[model samples]
Target: MEKLKEVHVSRDEKEAMLSEAMGQWWLGAIGTMMKTMGPEATMKAYGPTMRQIGRDRASRFIKEKGYKGHDVMATASVIRIWEKMMGIEGQFLEASTGRVVFRNTKCPLSGTVPQARPSLEYAM
Candidate 1:
């Protein structure tokens, strides 16, 4: 009989795995919903819920980061943090008091579920 070696995963690796799994699950679920319910109906049903989730996450992020102001820079900083967390490859074209522009080159959710794109774009 052969003995198996123990394997360990680092926290960062675990987080990445979890993030990828969640993204895949969301894409699959949304794709299914869009197919069954139609885009408009699916959006109508889930749009407000998604907005609330975003607001809640933003609030928690601000609190956790101890962000003082809701200024453009602060918002941009939070966005940058989110991009990194989500494994999104992107560049900030401009981040100013008046504007914050970002171009995403790669997304964690991209190319995973093509049918979900149209519905997910609205949520995004």
Candidate 2:
């Protein structure tokens, strides 16, 4: 008989692992979709769906967080927070009443799914 050593994982480590697994799953699923449906068809199908999902999520976030203002800065703040939580590295070049500008340096999904960049950009 062989003894197995106990291994402990911290919460942050578990979250990182889960996030990585999700990114892999997303890459696989998107790649499969692009292959089977073709990029144009995939974008046509996924674009609206993802936009709706984003809208729903934003609505929920606003409601849950009791967010009031709907100005550009307010929206930017929410997006910035959400991106940080998703482990997206970015710099906000400008966020004002008129506009919000963000420059993404690193994205978990982008590096792994270069072929699906068009579809991803369409979704965003």
Candidate 3:
């Protein structure tokens, strides 16, 4: 079950703080500070998130490193770390670019991708 608690912080402040970290993830020292802090400190530091507002300020790529599978409470802080590190207004740095490498027609790399005729161009 999701733990419900009454903390303190304004929505605007929370957004500002998280977005600030998201935009400036290169700062390793501050990130270290966050990693070392306790759970309560994390909540206090990054509180007041809204229901509708997403963790990212931009596209889906920004959330590539986000937690998959069941939503466990233990990794909430780590999720925040990833969000701050990757979530931005554009392409995500952490996610693979959905790239699939395929061999050319004559290149003997694999027997899987058969050579296609001129009529059918298979997009790998």
Candidate No. with top lDDT: 2
Tens digit of per-residue lDDT, candidate 1, span 3-66: 9998899999998899778877887888888788888888898889888887899888768877
Write one digit per residue (lDDT tens) for candidate 3, span 33-100: 44577434543554444211333432342466463432333233344444344331123233223432
lDDT (0 to 1) per candidate? 0.77, 0.79, 0.38
TM-score per candidate, in order?
0.75, 0.73, 0.19
Better of 1 and 2 by lDDT: 2
The model with the greater lDDT, 1 or 3, is 1
Ranking of predictions according to lDDT: 2, 1, 3
Q: Determine which window of 10 residues in candidate 2 has minimal summed lDDT.
A: 115-124
Name the runs in model 2 displaced over 4 angstroms: 1-19
Q: What shift in Å separates residue 33 of candidate 1 from its native position after superposition?
A: 1.0
Rank candidates by TM-score, best first: 1, 2, 3
The local lDDT score (0 to 100) that residue 20 gets in candidate 3 is 67
Clashing pairs in 1: none
lDDT of 2: 0.79
- Model 1 CA deviation exceeding 4 Å by range: 1-16, 115-124
